[model samples]
Target: MSSNAALLFQGGIGVIGLVAMLLFGIPVLLVGPGLWPSILLGALGASLTYAALLLLTRVPGLFPENLERQMQGLYDFASSYSPVVLILLSLLAGVGEELLFRGAIQGWLMANTDPVTAVLAASVLFGLVHYVSFTYFLVATGLGLILGAAYVLSESLVLVMVWHALYDMIALYCLLRFPRWFGVRIVDPVTNRPHE
Candidate 1:
């Protein structure tokens, strides 16, 4: 498929995921108060995981690329927005996604099976929910595992929600405002090549 087509498809997937989450997540909030803390913890846990990943990359010969530079670019974009917008973005991403993936799917699975099996099933569904390119799918799967673990580890969705929001905000900010930092160059794929 053409690059434009591929981009459009990816965008579509993101929208679909958002919509699905909204459709199923709102009711859970009405049912009980306990779920809120789980959501909060899930978000926080995810954010911490990201920090750990960054630190891991700092070890010698660990991170080959300039990941820190990319992070700075993301920060730059995030800084551009007002505090309100940032908070809203974080809420929507953290709460919405966790509710759908962990709250709905994982919660259901755990009700009927072992925690390990439930997490595995939920993680796979989480990955599939964000269906994009193959590489994106792999990344999403890895992310799902992290999010799932947060839920199981703390039995809280709050951590994962925060983590998911921060993760997406950083990525969105980087992509929208600092494409170059991420090593993305919009050259013709047919003729693109590395410098020797």
Candidate 2:
């Protein structure tokens, strides 16, 4: 895709995040009460997420065959972009998606229902939003649960944002750089390496 098109999509994601924050009153962002503590918690969350990613990709028969196709598509698409653009896209997704999913969806649910209910419902919605395949939906939902737990534990939207962004950045790098990890074998024409 063209850079301008990518930027436009990135901006749309950010706009959605802002809208969610506005609706749910999460404007404080990094200035929220537990900022310092959340930072450490975010790092911890990222570590846990990374472990999950590794397990999902590395374990045989853990993910269905379709997931290999899903990863192959992701690798092909991601490998087309410059690494910097990919990082920026992942960062936007982290911040924007967290704001919408954790800050708004889960936050509102917490107010209207129980905490566990809120997390599950929001996680389901998060999974639905990123639905590329059933396997992908499950993966996204599981990831959402992790992020939701981080948000609840720290009571900080920024924590999940940081955790998510770091995880995406690293995951994207790995997905593109090591397609074989996900049972893919295509070499990225742009990078002249990895699965194409």
Alpha-carbon lDDT, every model: 0.61, 0.79
The worst-scoring run of ten residues by lDDT in candidate 2 lies at 24-33
**lDDT measured at residue 178 in model 1 versus the true structure, 0 to 100:** 53
Q: Per-prediction TM-score, please?
A: 0.56, 0.85
RMSD of model 1, in Å?
7.8
In the range 126-147, model 2's lDDT, one tens digit per residue, is: 9998899988998899999988
* CA error at residue 74 for candidate 1, angstroms: 13
The positional error of residue 155 in candidate 2, measured at the CA in angstroms, is: 0.4
Model 2 TM-score relative to the real fold: 0.85
Tell me the alpha-carbon RMSD of every candidate.
7.8, 3.2
In candidate 1, position 189 carries an lDDT of 50
lDDT of 1: 0.61
